[model samples]
Target: MNLKFLYFVIFMLCLGQNLRAQYVEKEEEEKITTLYPEAVFDSIQAKKALALGKGKITGVAFTKTAPLAPRIYADNMKIMLFPVTPYFEAWYKLRNSKENLRKRRYVYMSDAAFRYRLEAISNSVGKFTFPDMKPGKYFLTGNMSWSSTGSYNEHTGTSYGSYGTQADHYEKRYYTQNHEERLEKFVEVKTDGEIVEVKLK
Candidate 1:
């Protein structure tokens, strides 16, 4: 082949390769965009089921005094659902204290005491949801607290007889205050997939 013809063929081949690569990259990008839509759609359908009263609980948890407490949206604050039984109710009554039910640790107590639990974190607006729960009586609890600690040092100096001074001594004192609140209620779920509202006060 002549030099010009060979060069033209090589250029055409390079152009085809570039076009193929660009097409593949575009396909990959399109695929990524299309991915995960089904999951999102499924979640929307589940929420619709909740709206139709499909054994789901959804509501906002807030204090009665001020509905917009920062702790209401805190990540450590949680909404817990436990089956309502005599034993579970008694256990909740006994362990219900500021010290025991503070932040996320409130949900960490003896799980053996209850048959099972379903929990959800409060969103930025203090909204929580428990989807697809069984039809039965359930006990719900929500608690949150904020605490601050401070320390101070005290110095005491004494002078001995005639210009004699004793060494200086200091004592440190520390204090902490935990402001917390707890809300509890018993709810029943119907078999026909009913949405139940359990608001924490």
Candidate 2:
């Protein structure tokens, strides 16, 4: 009976090892497939930080072309702008007064406190008109994430092990940030050439 029990334990251990190997292989294949998209879609542009100040700063402007009434209806409106280029980058300083460097916290894309742009824009300077947002202060910012489709390696096992050896390895690095500040607030029906400029807060 003892011999039979010992044999069963050995068989179960071997089965577990085989299952782990298969699962690892399946996960690796899925990871590889996910990294590459179906086709070569438009490239994602990288955004620089926005510089903040008390005075005017160069930012994209937007205007409403159609006659938007207080209680009017519209199906669609065209927005004229430049194609979004990755080279365009800007940064804004949030505070007007001098503060401790350590007290400053760098806000990232995932933060909930930061505001966001309802409509998406590809370029830096362009006219963007969307369904009229409610009359209130809104935050405008950008989010970005990037990854490299590659693998790396490092030494494994102990430096002074009985059978020291090297092994394959892989790593993933993630980077993202956010820019947020109160934008213009609108109360009445904005005219056709209502220009909204993005400036340092």
Candidate 3:
């Protein structure tokens, strides 16, 4: 073969190999993001995995007003498992700030760090499970709200004086107070693969 043709063929082969390597690297990165989305935003979980271990956490959330009484099921409850990190602590503080109330209108909406935290919804029977969590301190929280309606009577009085005589008129108005009752709890998880029971009041 001519030297020119040989050089052209070698260049083509090298280009193909380079393209293949790029494709493989991209695929591996995408897979990691899919499995551990938080790794893209922060290295906390990755560092924890390297230092400690990973395991599963399962539990149930219920409400019990009276002791020894059958607990009320808290179905479809949202449970969050947040790693104990400075980022998480700051987020928690921001979440509870009155000045940021307008910004935090949606409880489900969160940043990448918070969103990647392990989360689960309780089943019909109030059972929830979070599997494959890195071994570390995790802040557990759950919230559930129900609609409530109540009625109250308001009284209004007016007085008038004319011709040295006083007269008063009174009125009563009935009002309905429609509000929501929210149940929430904050707990700490110290062990992995251990069941943590949370009671909401």
Candidate 4:
């Protein structure tokens, strides 16, 4: 192949790759403005209604977990759970005044409501909101559980059994114990808010 033509082809390939990268970046920016079904509060009235009857107007928040190294957008942030579940109770945790997390905050939703015949899962899942947050932060963390309970006496444990002769006793045991209300895994989020809108090509 001619040297000039070969160099030109190589240059074009590099150019195409660069364009693809730019396209990806542009796409990410567009996602920032995109809206989720439950996240969308198209009108002021709708926004007001959701906040109404709800205790203390705590802000809403959301995070995207997929697309590994997920792209985060301010617009993708949601103030409400898309689909509410009565099986759990959700709450927010702000930074204590003397805490190192004064600027950083968290929220949790535990499953430990026993009053209504509910045995809350041991873990609690939470969404975080930041009224004053620094930009360029990549991830957020929290935890979740399938159930929870507050009563201490309700704690339960397992029992064991044995078989065979006393001289040669073979024993077996089962783990049927339930633990006290304890926190679980910490989930990290890349974005703190909603995704911004983009100009469609």
Using lDDT as the measure, the top candidate is 1
- What is candidate 3's lDDT per residue for 1-201, written digit by digit as tens? 899999999999999888777444334432111111222345566246324334556667776546996776667878776675655555556556675564443233235565555668988777887666545666667665433344554445556677676656655555544333355455544565544555545
Model 4: ten consecutive residues of lowest lDDT:
114-123
lDDT score at residue 7, model 1, on the 0-100 scale? 98
Instruction: Estimate the overall C-alpha local distance difference test score of candidate 2.
Output: 0.31
What lDDT does candidate 4 reach at residue 28?
47
Off by over 4 Å in 3: 1-43, 46-56, 63-71, 97-110, 147-184
- Mind giving the per-residue lDDT tens digits that candidate 2 earns over 76-105? 222221211222111112221134234453
Report lDDT per candidate. Answer: 0.62, 0.31, 0.58, 0.28
Least lDDT summed over 10 consecutive residues: which range in candidate 2?
83-92
Candidate closer to the true structure by TM-score (higher is better), 1 or 2 = 1
lDDT of 4 by residue, 106-148 (tens): 3323323211111111111222332322122112222221222
> Of the candidates numbered 2 and 3, which has the greater TM-score value?
3
RMSD in Å for all candidates: 21.4, 20.2, 24.8, 24.5
In angstroms, the error of model 2 at 27 is: 41
Instruction: For each candidate, give its TM-score against the true structure.
Output: 0.45, 0.22, 0.45, 0.16
